[model samples]
Target: MGQVITFGEVLMRISPRGKKKFIQSNVVEFFFGGTELNVGVSIANFGGNVKHIGVVSEDFIGDTAISYINKFGVDTSSIGRSKRPLGVYFFEVGAVMRPSTISYNRSHSSFSEIKPDMVNWDEALIDGEWLHWTGITPALSQGSFDVLKEGLQKAREKGLTVSADPTYRRGLWQYGKDPKEALSELLHYSTIFIGGINEINEILGTEYSYSNEDFIRASKQLMQAFPSIEKVFDKIRTSLNSSWHKIRARMWNGKKFHETKDLDITHIVDRVGTGDAFAAGLIYGLRRFDDCKAMEFGSAACALKHTYEGDVNLTTVSEVTTILEGDISGRLNR
Candidate 1:
């Protein structure tokens, strides 16, 4: 398998310790994560070859971020540095019934300063077999959108599989570009769609409900509109509250629909990056397993991510496999 190429911003996540509110905490914790970076790190942790391309502040903070990514064995050679500060978000981890809150301070960050010419996509994607991108990149700025589009185009030319996770954020599209237009354009280059009904409805400007029947209908319509999308994989989450959730995945791969059983997560250590984990697992599994097994792998990985605290999923491949093999007993290793 060739390297998995991930392109997006590198963000520093700052959060109050545990379930305490910002006003109640005197101490905080920080982690290095971004949607694409989290997926890259999780893939690397699973012993996959992965490379990340992004810009960070040309300061100690950026240095530390690079080091943190390097610690996960992710190739960061394509990453650049800028005078602007690294993007940061303050998160307050919430418990049952209460929801989590996040505030972004990334408007003028180093990643938003990215330009098309800043990266040599041909060189960055030379050894890449899969390229993953999210809606967050293009939502930041015109420069970021142009840069991502350039990379996607190059990946297409190189015959690499492009995975699109249209993680649309209504508040992030303040750059005047139509969200539907931008995402629809990128979808033309993507082969796999790693999103659900909400994303499809957002991009296609259709109102689709959350039913499985609607999902199949929406997915069929999506493929009809964008024939390049060969397969659609969705991770469905049922949140009983902030602490307890159930995850299951379903896929429409042109000819058939496959679904997985619900994986219950009774105590979520953290909710962030669980979707990215699903994407990573699906990417990894597709290389080795069939479509149904891949969806099962993704759903299991997503459930396991809630057991770890941070924006990145650190669970190993064996651990995820253990869960997939029906071993959710939380047994001791010793």
Candidate 2:
């Protein structure tokens, strides 16, 4: 088993319970979420030797984040704590006919201000074998983008396997320049690429498409463009309305391809970190089983994430094993 390392910001997610806006909020729940840190936590929960690499504010909020992370047995020594303020996300959950919304207060996030030297690129993943990153990181600022490139170069030199999923938060990107150039640089460095086609199209410079075959072909072009990359994966969605969606995914594993039927993800509590959950599952399978069996296992884990309530997935290894053994009926487990 190899160690896993992830780099990105960690935010305190404050979300309203039922159907209350931020101004009209009476009840709210607090859960920590940042795509990269969430992925690190999930990997740690599965007993992976995981270390979250990023900068955190030296304030009370940063302390709070570290406390919760410590409870999960994550290594925080490598996580830098600075004199900055922590970042947060305000979310408003919606009911059947309503739509949910999330607002990020991560403008001056500690991790966003990261410099290349903050992470000793050559030393960070010295004991690690896998590195995972999200698209959200490079969208922060020029310094962070440089830091990612520095880190990726080191990871490549160390012969580490890299996985990237550009979750595509278009709202956060338009900082200084276009997102295409930066996104492409990072994608070229990744071996396991996981993302959605619609969000990726903007970065790939393509036109509108409602065709599945077209998506696979375009995604294939990207995979072929980067010979270092072994697989290209993305989730597909058919929206019936604001709150209801039918979601499925397809994968191209260098040699063969596979796709699954869309699962009705009606009880979506937090659709934010589901993509990371899928990537985590996929990588876990790829490391454990052969190519074909791996994607099947990954797709099952993602389908299970839809039924859970938080950004962190609740599917246990035993549950995933059951699903992997050809059971998507998802009966209750008590």
Candidate 3:
């Protein structure tokens, strides 16, 4: 029985080891990443029983994925496999003022063609306290959306809390349907809903400023639009450069809206998976303590992501705690 169950694709991320780009470099490194998978992996790293549910190709890449995710302590027994090839992504980690670029080669991959009846949700979420997913799945295909809705409903009936990140990526959804339709439908069933304010505005057909008031209005509107959401967490960021960032998060938990202070992050090795890190932290907070302290852990975890170089963060619990304690002094640990 898993305590945390998540479903999402996992891709092989190929990029240069440091700041060099593809054309300007040789000797690129390999790591695996998928937002849903990242959340499950992070929970496992923090000493939780985490299960990753997704389909992978039966080829060599799929074989490698089992090994890759196993190292992070996620239970891999619940995954589905097919005789196809896994998806691949190319990344160029930005430096200075340049934005990072991602080129996905995932068309016709395992997940895009996944069937809804592939996994036994009853067994997968038997003792699950939480089930999480993202809007990205709906963008993949209608089949995947049905699979997610089924899994989440089963979790709901079993009295498990459902959480989701409306990580609306522009490139993922195909087949001529707007993301708003699918996302709105899914959000109606979620206990907690999270998203980027900018992403939501684009879908909502509105303009918003970068101030707290703007996000405050956005959360209020989204919460009213979908009443199943008891809480909304928005991770607000202000980028200074490719290597540094200022971030804070706000939460609207039914009763009131709360905001955390801005955290200055330096030496950011990667940013792709940071939002998932925030969600993991927020979920942990929801399960462990009151909303304020939970927000603290969630914010701190995002800071720790800036220090790591892969899709799954490689930092220790103590390290995250130190950051949570406001020690950005960067002292070495034993």
TM-scores, each model vs. reference: 0.99, 0.92, 0.95
Full-model lDDT for every candidate: 0.95, 0.77, 0.82
Which has the higher lDDT value, candidate number 1 or candidate number 3?
1
Tens digit per residue, CA lDDT, model 1, 1-334: 8999999999999988989999998999999999999999999999999999999999999999999999999999999999999999999998999999999999999999899989999899989999999999999999999999999999999899999999999999998999999999999999999999999999999999988889999999999999999999999999999999999999999889988999989999998999999999999999889999988998899999998989899999999999988999998899
Model 1 TM-score? Answer: 0.99
Q: Write the per-residue lDDT of candidate 2 for residues 7-84, one digit (tens) a residue.
A: 888888887775588788677888876888777776666666787888889988898889888777777778898787
* Model 1 worst lDDT window (10 residues): 294-303
The deviation in Å at residue 47 for candidate 1 is 0.6
Candidate 2: where are CA atoms >4 Å away?
Answer: 208-210, 326-334
In model 1, state the lDDT of residue 122: 84
- Winner by TM-score between candidate 3 and candidate 2: 3
Any residue pairs clashing in model 2, and if so which?
Answer: none
Task: Spell out the clash pairs found in candidate 3.
Answer: none
RMSD of each candidate relative to the true structure: 0.7, 2.1, 1.7
Output the better candidate (1/2) by TM-score.
1
lDDT (0-100) at residue 93 of candidate 3?
87
Q: List the candidates ranked by TM-score, beginning with the highest.
A: 1, 3, 2
Candidate 1: where are CA atoms >4 Å away? none
